[model samples]
Target: MRSLLMVSAGVAMLGLTAPAAAQNMPAPMHMMPHDGTLLTVVAEGRTTRTPDLATIRAGVTTQAATAAEALAQNSTRMERVLAALRRAGVAERDIQTASIQLNPQYRYQENEPPVITGYQAVNMVSVRFRDVAKSGSILDVLVREGANNINGPSLSLDDPAAALDEARRDAVARAAARAQLYASAAGLSVDRIVSISETMEGAGPQPPMMVSARAQSESADTAIVPGEQDVTVTLTFRFLLK
Candidate 1:
């Protein structure tokens, strides 16, 4: 079916850097849901913000001839890591045990059955840092206290309600702009909005731009650079043109 003046657009994150072309055609009467020309405008709202929180996976891994021995060594190191976290003002609620694993290392032979050589133990926790600026120093302390395996610094906002609301407003504005453009092209004006709805594309914490700190000495330090993440909300607006 032909449209009177169809406007459909896609926007880039952080800003509407690119916009899809708007198409104008002869008005059709059979394919609309209203008396006048029906215009459906789809637009995305986006905002870039520096993350306010960091989630780090810090742990200790140890290998020994037996599972019991490996676990013992890992426990000893993990205690010190916990102590350092508490000393650095990390709240107990922000730290949670992720996993505790013990596996047997096997030596494979060409024709003989596999024989167990040693056992490896790993203890890990998911640590959330509310203060992104100070997380680097805290990570350094964790390293000094015997955290051998560390990863992530998953960046995110503490409370995204405000940012998402901002995006919602942006979407509405974009939809309005596109609708006006459509009305003008079709030799009509925007009468009113027939319907409006939103689609949140799950604008959660961006992927981890991790500064992995692994097997570092006391003299070494870690740094966390919180870049920017895009929070986006997509909206579809149905406007009537008269």
Candidate 2:
């Protein structure tokens, strides 16, 4: 019995000492040193290409005394617009109704409750024109049929792979140029590139700087300029300093 008691006491002491030993152990090592010097740099690149695709939004609106009448009128005008789109070689899938809303019109009165005047229904459709060259004629036809609301002929590149490749090449060149500049300023030389990361920012028609699209409200024939699109790429690179 005395031998068993001594064994139990030794086991208890070992358990207590194990916890204390673990608490005194150092933490695991990290891959990078805390005092290591690193450089952070950003490089930007842009490429311009003519847009090949055009997107537009068109629709009709109607107002009547009753909601049913307003809706019917809106539906008729929208049907006519769709028909016009079909006639212009726009496929069924390319034409889609984007918005349809019906709300009651209100009239304000001095020191009195608001009164309902009429119900207005608005229907908007988004159309994609693969052939951007003939967009003017299409707009004319849509307006003649009953379309009153037209948004834009937003242009874009159909295949942006070539432009993206150009942008990436430029980005790398920019990164290298910046690294060299920093190295020269610090009286060092860039030995090797340790890591490279890239992010794509924008790939669409460039914003209008001097010229804007003419509004359809003033004229039936819409003039579109398939201007240049800007594709941009940004990159970050880590270079080893020597």
Candidate 3:
């Protein structure tokens, strides 16, 4: 009986010691340091290329004493313009009607409130030309077909993904070089890249080149110059200092 009691007392003591030992043990450590030196740098890169595609905005405007007359004249001219585009191999899907409007023409005089001079009708369409080389000739055809109010020949790349990727690579390389230079200047070394973020600028379609009414009326084909467009990217890099 005494040995049984002694064994029970020893088990109770062991249980108490186990809990105390567990409480005194150290906590698990975190993998990342709580306080570390970080360096941030921003860099920009650009790539230039001649645009491959062109978007043209063409329209016809007509004025008549009556609204019906104005609309009829405008429609007749617009149909011819559309037919010319179709003959030039511009796909139906590539042609979109931008706007059609009929507004009353008003003559404002200082002495009089307002005077209704006539009615004006306008029809506009946006055309996308996959073959940029032929865009000038096409514009001439449009003008011949009675497209009086013509604008644009906006230049752009059909696929900007490749250019954007190249810009990104350039941006990252520039960022790394800058970071290294700054780290060395601070008497430190770049251990690793903690984070990186990028922003794209000037990657959308470039401003459209304007075509004058006189230029459209000229006998020669419109002179279309697809200038080089710049694709730019900016990168922000966060690097760990060692």
Candidate 4:
């Protein structure tokens, strides 16, 4: 009989301690709002702006009987291209060496062993243009300065944080408006927000465009058309209906 009483007392203590521990635990991100019905809504917000910056890839390819000769020839031409960029007001910090390679050119036959014809060397630099309007003209100069290969004019906003914040605000407003509409339809009032999650959808890159050596954007001039770019934000919101 004494043991039974002691066991009952221990169980009572355990029950008290369990409640206290649960109260001390941190709240979950998606905690229910006092047993109210939850209403979830998803919406998207998009903002459009013209790109203000651009990136271009320019390089030279050289061939020679020896790897050393090919590399030397490539290095000289690449220097000319770099100088042209400098003359065009391109900052040194804006130019980055993307790649340099020397490979043996091989001629393959069906039954015979492959023969090494010559060595080819390639050097490339990635250049950023702060002013997209002048980028095309500068590219023409690069081609004239012995850049044999060119690709891209990847356009983007210089700073996207402000635009993204605007998008977020739009997303929140859209989600709340949608949830409120649902609450009204169900004859319930929106009590509080349970949770919110967001996804950023940035603009996609432009297709890769290539220009041969000395080729210009147009006759006697070059033009860069920066079409409108869209930045999107998607949000899911959970609200409690009282």
Highest-scoring model, lDDT: 1
Q: CA shift at 63, candidate 1, in angstroms?
A: 0.8
As for candidate 1, its clashing pairs are none
- Tens-place lDDT per residue, model 1, 118-206, is 99999999999999988888888888888888878788888889889999999999889988876776678898886777898646666
Off by over 4 Å in 3: 1-33
TM-score (C-alpha, index-matched) for candidate 3: 0.83
N/CA/C clash count, model 4: 0
Candidate 1 accuracy as TM-score = 0.84
Query: What would the per-residue lDDT of candidate 3 be over residues 131-150, giving only the tens digit for each residue?
Result: 88889889998998899988
lDDT of each: 0.78, 0.70, 0.77, 0.75
Clashes of 2: 0
* lDDT measured at residue 188 in model 3 versus the true structure, 0 to 100: 67
- Candidate 4 stretches with Cα past 4 Å from truth are 1-30, 203-208, 217-219
RMSD of 1: 6.6
Model 2 spans with C-alpha error above 4 angstroms: 1-37, 205-220
Which is better, 2 or 3, measured by TM-score?
3
Q: What CA RMSD would candidate 4 show?
A: 11.1
Q: Rank the candidates by lDDT, best first.
A: 1, 3, 4, 2
Candidate 1 regions with alpha-carbon error over 4 angstroms: 1-6, 9-34, 214-219
User: What range of 10 consecutive residues in model 3 has the weakest lDDT sum?
Assistant: 1-10
